[model samples]
Target: MQIDFSRSIVDIVLDHGNSIPDRTALIFDQGDGAQSSLTYAELATRITQLAGALSARGLAGRRIALLFSAGTDFALALLACLAAGGVAIPLAPVGRRKARLQNILNMLGDIRPDCILLDDSMAALFGDELSAALAVGPVRYLEFAALAAEPHPFAALTLRPDQLAVLQFTSGTTSNPKGVMISHGNIIANEAMIQVAFGHDQDSHFVGWVPHYHDQGLFGNILQPLFLGSTCVITSPAAFINRPMFWLQLITRYGAHTSGGPNFGYDLCVDFATRRGMPDDLDLSGWRVAFNGAERVRPGTLDRFAECFADAGFDRRAFLPCYGLAESTLVTIAVPPQSDPIVKSYDSRALAAGRAEESKDREGVLELACCGPAMAGAEARIVDPATGAALPDGAVGEIWLRGPHITAGYIDNPAATEASFGRLDEGAPFLRTGDLGFAAAEGFFIVSRLKDLIIVRGRNHAPSDVEQIWSELSGTVGQASAAAVEIEMGDTQHIVLIAEMKRDDARALSDEKVQEMAGRLRAMAMERLELAVTDLVLVSASTIPRTTSGKVQRKQAGRMLMDGELTVLAMAGPLAQAFGPSEQGASAAGQSALR
Candidate 1:
């Protein structure tokens, strides 16, 4: 499993094609019992042919935007672009949604790719939109099918370690999207780290549904398998969202050894099983490493999932809570395979004060899942955000990382690059991840995003902690996705809770009943965290926006609430005045009674 840093991943593809041409390299599950697979020979041949075609077209060092859905086409396009010495910009296929399409168009305008690569089917589907994209700049469209039809003789291009391979765009949950420059060396180093940390080899199998545009899906689910010359089974994100059980079924069918996604994916599976009941024949014994990353790994989610599927031969030790971002090229910290996730209860007040204090008692405690130590050849440190002084263990601060896997910086944005990637006190270069966490003996425990921290009366309250507490208390709110944000009112900062209620619950509750529930939530917040909930706005389900990676966009939610963009089902407290005049009058009369 030793990775050769001297050779690029393109070279590995060629080697695999030559040595194990008959072995299956990739499989795409169509989610209806139908699947497609490609052998190593086919993959390498296609990549070489398409790469040759691209190079022959004078696109050796140009930016190519891949706009294919998650499938063999996307995988082939990405590898071929890299092989041809072109910068690959993998983007999710923009469907009919205007907002999503506009977002893609905006990104394209910023990147200004030389050519947009798509399959024949995709080009036909988005024919009109593709026409509109031409207005952004002088960009040509290249179909993979057309490129593959005419194969040209191609010689492997010499690649440098620092050569840019991918422009991974951040999910933009907290800010506008910026492309993270991932070098060839960064990918190789991170792949090696993942192979060692996750205990993967050629015999290992992977099945996942994370979108290939995301780093986790592209690197972990796809490239990592290629790195080990292993088979990887992939399905679209829609397939997994439509039926979470299909993800589990794929693992069962493939006897996959490594596969996972964000905490929400596990939560969905658990919820699906809870309502429909788990199938008795399903077995997950072969699942050795179920990594949870790209978002906070909730301990409750892990516990519920393990208990829910225990009868199906699912092992609790298979859970690997990890922490990473696109800037790291994929994984930075990951728990070893077959290790039980580390969970600890810390005093809520101490964590709020930027220090971790272990608490044995059940009252006023926050249970956090530990994202294990930095991967091999990587170093992680917690430093005070204000002074850049390194903090000792148990002190919550910004997590700084230094490793070969760490990407250089954001592309075309030197100010952002300078601000994010810097040396700590004249030491080695480190990526100042805007995440807040602390390192303990076990590993690192993420608290919240430094930007998402809700401050009220000068005390830092992690929005995740508040959201979790609200979720536990809000019974039958139906898919309790809550966003706790700080809204400034007349000379005072107020803690506002915007939550989603099921359609059934939203229609069944009377105005009086909604007020009562809001009052109870406010009372509970006061009793539990000693923080007053200034307002509670209940909206329909899926109202809150989330990044493609499933991280809640707290900042965007606050903006929507202030802009009156959200459709409110019910409201309580002073902020209710923003909803309408009737609510304003009602709130004015009943605000005192509720308080």
Candidate 2:
């Protein structure tokens, strides 16, 4: 009954029944504080029978897609696919992107899996042969539970360490997504490193509403628990977005020791308290690792969150600043859990000049939070993006990493792989994070986004520079009113602006005054920066899409502008044609979580 780390984890499940069988490996919460449990023994027996089922149907080594709701079934289906040596293409909730179930089918069709595993509800809607034909050609549908009932074929197969275990799709910078090829070795290494860095163990538990298909949720919330023999409670992100308190309640209910998300969750929770009467004295003392990452790590967001939850007994020390990308398998560096998050303030102009210059000027000073140091064996460096020369300490440059946990490259993107991961001036090869940050005397802090900048006419401009302008505006919380992205229209760079309206100003001022304010802001941007902002989107307060930590989802906002759904100023001429008034906020219909 020895657990084989090198073989299919399904094989390892065979050992679960012999030892620690009754221990709960997963806790499924339905977001309303209701819960269900699945022990290691129960999960192992089900997966074993499922592997037997898939083998009975000749599904071994065949590709299968899992379009599922977050539950024990979702986890079981994925493990079953792997136990039988079938490739699992998981599709989880991602906001608005998978609105139409047909789009889900199309993405799955691209993979052309032999069969699809779906929840009973999803099967009712998209599983009909007629809809399946219309959805994306003929892909057979199978209920998740059906697999567990199949007779035991019991032809156990072992996976080579290099064989593909999970073929996760990464939302690359490009419009089209690319599959991130993860081997058995990559998955195994990430879990082991995560177990050590994050202190995951059998006694530990994870509660997340993060999208399961994304690397962060899949690896951190789902697989990390599986590898460490702990309990993971996962729910759909849409559920939490609908009720932000659902996250806290889950932690309180499950006694979850660990939970984290992007900055948006913190903002949303605060906004909820202001708008609706949320429970005080919420009792989050059981929370151990309450870190936040995924995008910009905001100091104010953390402070505000700690202050908000202080009455609820949430410990401020549990808040940690961590950083990672899909390229590195979710985490590159994590500040020791509950460490005082470091914030490095810098000069705006000098930083825009491709030189990270530290400044103490209280006015207009930008604070970038520390993402801690590298994990055990991982190495990190800050290099000048232009010449690849290693930058001195205190200088902001592109973040590069080399580690056992890092993936080699995008599956088939040879050009990008070559451009991103390669030999650095420091002897060995490294993967460029395409992120702008400095290794502070304290450790890693991403100051600005490398590729998220814009060159208007001839001046190098950072979107954070514009975002900072919105920050100083009276009555605007840090990210309440700013997302700047340059849209390419012919040869020149056309700036697309998405800003949040101050509630007081929106309520008190006339529509004309609001328009005037927006116009003045645009004019100020042009005059100060010498850039023509083609469109201005004045959204209602608290509408901007930011990670749980405060990084703006500029690409998503840009997509909204490109679709003419973002309404800022009047749609006039080119601006009117591009920024149509769609008026869909964060929680819109047809929106599902990320895949």
> TM-score winner among the candidates?
1
TM-score of 2: 0.85
Model 2, 1-595: lDDT tens per residue? 1223564455555566568788788777765657777888988877778888887887887778888766778788888888888878876433353355656756765766788778776666556742446455556667876666566856667777667767777654423565666766667766676666777677788888877777788888887777777778888777787888878888887788888887667777876876786775477998989768776777777877888788788888887778887777778688887566667777655555656566787644566777888877678999888888888877768898987666767665788778888778655479888888777667887766677777654446667656655555533545536887876654445576677765455456665665665566566655444445665556666656644223467776776655445544332224444333434432232122210
Which lDDT tens digits does candidate 1 get at residues 27-88?
99966767789999999998988888999898887999988877888889899899999999
Runs in model 1 with CA error above 4 Å? Answer: 1-3, 94-96, 132-136, 475-480, 581-595
Go through the candidates in order and give each one's C-alpha lDDT.
0.84, 0.69
Clashes of each: 0, 20
RMSD of 1: 3.3
Worst 10 residues of 1 by lDDT: 582-591
